[model samples]
Target: MSSPEHKQLIWNLIKDIKVGMLVTKELNDEDGLRARPMSLVQDAYDGTLYFFTSKTDAKAFEIAQDKDVCLTFSNPKDNVYVSLTGKAKLSEKRDLIDQYWNKWVAAWFKNGKDDPDVAILEVKISKGEHWDSTNNKLVQLFEVTKSNIFESSTPNLGESKKFGTE
Candidate 1:
């Protein structure tokens, strides 16, 4: 079963959201962590994130040793933000790669889907949390007027070790 609040948070942050930063720690622990913007695939509900990648990429190598992964999605215009945690791995589904293939991809990868390096990076999300910049100005004003409503209106749905207000 999924909590309405948690499910809503995920939908709001991901359903129409296009891009996010996927950050992974290096297995060497030699100050080699990495973060890159990605065209996010849909959440599989089984707690995983799917990313377009290549077989020989450093990201895949990192996942090979350290499976843990975290992704961040933020809307600067709305001030809404989400942090997703999971484990990452490379997938061998050629059909899935061809599905996302397009002209733009052709421009970037030359031969496009035919590239031998192409692969999918899948992240199995264990949990996620969000901080939403409330959309209702009237509601915000009401909260300010009531003073205590600030704590009531904002919802923190995940138990990340660190929480942010902005």
Candidate 2:
């Protein structure tokens, strides 16, 4: 898909999640992952998810080592959730930080970027898959009820696992 479309899908699914469990690798152990609930930091729909975090955090250290992080946003009420896994880049540009900073973020930015703990986590979309149930429920029912009859009038979006690979 095109870049704008790709970014939109991500923004729509993850934006409402507000707070999500972020899965980042543990620097001490490659096989270990550290998960935390954060008020999902984000930037504009430019195909990259930006998160405001501390550079000294364990999760940050892991990203620095491999840049691969998984961010999950699930709405229990809607039963819809999306998880994004990708490479990350730490940015300290004032403009980028200012664009995303809000009154709530003042506690961290107050000390400024030079603060040993301040940093931005930028995740590059490598591949992402989301379950769009509002559109899928009817189709799912049809498939189950007509398993031996008519089928496949609409393709599943979850089937599209190809993005950023080409």
Winning candidate number (lDDT): 2
Candidate 2 stretches greater than 4 Å from native: 108-116, 135-166
Best by TM-score: 2
Q: Alpha-carbon error at 15 in model 2, in Å?
A: 1.2
In candidate 1 the C-alpha lDDT for residue 121 amounts to 80
Candidate 2 residues 109-140, lDDT tens each? 66864566677777777776666565456766
Model 2 lDDT vs. the true structure? 0.70
CA lDDT scores, all candidates in order: 0.68, 0.70
User: Tens-digit lDDT track for model 1 on 29-91?
Assistant: 877788988876554334456667877777788888888778888875665678887778898
Which parts of model 1 have CA positions greater than 4 angstroms off? 1-9, 30-32, 42-46, 135-166
- Estimated TM-score per prediction? 0.70, 0.74
